[model samples]
Target: MQNDNMKCGLIEKTESQFVDSIEKEAYVWCEKNWKHDDYEHQHNRAQLTFVEEGYQYFHIDRKIYLVPQHHVIWIPSEKAHKITSEAQTVNLMVFLFKSVFEDEFYQNVQVFAVPPVLKEMLLYASKWNQSLDENEEQDLFFKAILKSLPNFCKESSSLEIPVPTDTRLIPVCNDINVNFKYNLDIDSLAEKAQMSVRSLQRIFKNETGITLQKYLQLTRILKSIELIDTRQYTLSEVAYKVGYQSLSAFTSSYFAIMQVKPKINKN
Candidate 1:
């Protein structure tokens, strides 16, 4: 699924050229196992990406979202962000649309479930790319998809983890992400941040709107998801790797946070 420009190592240049030259109201592009470089960029038209297989990580508004299979990532026009994935094989379908609808859903970054109908529409739209003519069949089809988005995209995914902004809490958050396998108690984190336990709890709650203990749980769950996606480790191995002493605890916590049972693909 590598395009000509991509095979020639000119993906960025080709995208810029298309954005500058294309005047159509809609565009669609499909790829397989595409690995975009690590950089932030934005577009004049709003963007929607459907993950048909594997998963993708989106960095938006200082938060990280891991969008798994059968999900969509929406980014509004002019919103700077970066998308990355560690999966070896990914099937992605991206759509770019002009700001025609006034729905608030189009104004923010969101990762949400993809309905069956939307998934079919995305697959059909994959036949066209770069630019679609106005009032044409492809254009009209995409317009209908955009009009129906708000209704279908109501329930957002809970796989997002917000990055702390406070200088004192940043390192603490970083340590939890890096050393999630270890037991990260309040005393250790408080000492690492050079603050009293009481002060750390107050500021952490104020900055991230979640207790430190809850944040640790979320970090471990999200990390577990990433590990599970790799399919190289069994569920028990993943649980231990993410700091859960028992598989039952890991499964319960994952279900509590994601509202879905974790699935392992060891093929």
Candidate 2:
């Protein structure tokens, strides 16, 4: 078997070749089983990625956003970001466009639900790649998609957790993420971070703009969403897996963050 360094080198080389092949004014790339290391990079062109089958975690702008299945995420030009897909097989569709539009919609990172019409459009566009001729027809087709984005991508979801840059809080956040299934109280977190409870609370809020309790709650909800998407567990099982003893409480928190009910895939 190849060693870890060899595997990483091969993946990086493959990614570099892939990026070099798509230097176009507009491009569409689709893939299945798309797995890559957490490579942080930025593009000169704005990007929109649709997760069709599996989920992806987008680390951008000091926040980690969960782009679950059937959701789309927009990343503006020159924004530093990295993506991690834990799933073994992920179906993804990506669109890259020149940052020519002055619309406010393309100015910020957003993860939103994909409506049926938009979904169809994305699927149809998947046939075209960077090699497509740059003519008026092609321009119009891409422009139509751009214009329609602001309309269809209105309901943004807050499936994100702000990351703190402070050194003292990094381990705290990591612990919460890794041990999300446990009831991690402030006192324990403070102890782990080797700080007073009040200092931890104040500094965490100052750095991440969210209280420790709220941050923990958001972390649990994010994990629950991932578990629910897997279809391997019931809703109650998902709730408990994310540290909630009460299913109703889990449902409430999930809805509040996602703005939609937990979709239990009964397949």
Candidate 3:
């Protein structure tokens, strides 16, 4: 006594037919580079970068942000931005087409919290390296990403380090980066920039959005972070390498900049 509806093979439907089909309008991929910096540029598609190796510095809309390893930085479409790397690093970059999501999704620069599920999805998406193009499994994965976007993540504390673009300050910036181990004085920086100390202070603040003292401190702390991540140096050694006179001072500055004391690996 098989029912006519059951006998009509209604239960044999394939999975693809039930899932809503979507046009793939985006891409994801991973890339590695050895110390590179790019000039400011804008694009029609939004970019999300997940750092895998070293620190990334992003300058967007006159402010700079520090993108540390395991973090994702999102740059909205058509925004002029520049990226610089501290060392050799890997980045999982996803370019999302504006048509795939709401306009609000592509509005601001954001640093997102990457929970385990989202992290795994990002990695999985990176493997596609191309649009889904009617592929069922890939389409499902992409669809899952869109579904998980709303509840899977939250905003974290932004790591911003402002850098001035004034050409007069370029030499000063280079000196600090190249010889960060030395105690740099404002007098010397002003002399190097061929301006009075007061003038330098005024202009630096007006242009960079951070005091010179804090900027220098942040630069050293960031360098210390890079050294510590190598796992080859002790806390004291890293402190000395970055020109901190005492471990206590270095730890204070590190905590101030990073919001956590560095976890030393004594192995």
TM-score of each: 0.88, 0.85, 0.70
Model 1: colliding residue pairs:
none
Per-residue C-alpha lDDT of model 1 across residues 5-42, encoded as one tens digit per residue? 54211244634332434566777877788777577766
Q: What digit string (tens of lDDT, one per residue) describes model 3 on residues 1-267? A: 233222111121232111212245455545665344366655555667777666687888767777777677777767777778655444445545434466465477877556787788788777666444556776666656755564654654336766678989988888888878988788999999999999999998888777777778888987887887677788999999999999999999888766668765343
Off by over 4 Å in 3: 1-23, 31-41, 59-64, 89-95, 100-105, 112-117, 124-131, 135-158, 264-267
Provide the global lDDT of candidate 1 against the true structure.
Answer: 0.79
Candidate 1 vs candidate 3: which has greater lDDT?
Answer: 1
Clashing pairs in 2: none
Of 1 and 2, the candidate ranking higher by lDDT:
1
Error of 3 at 120 (Å): 4.4
Each prediction's Cα lDDT score? 0.79, 0.77, 0.68
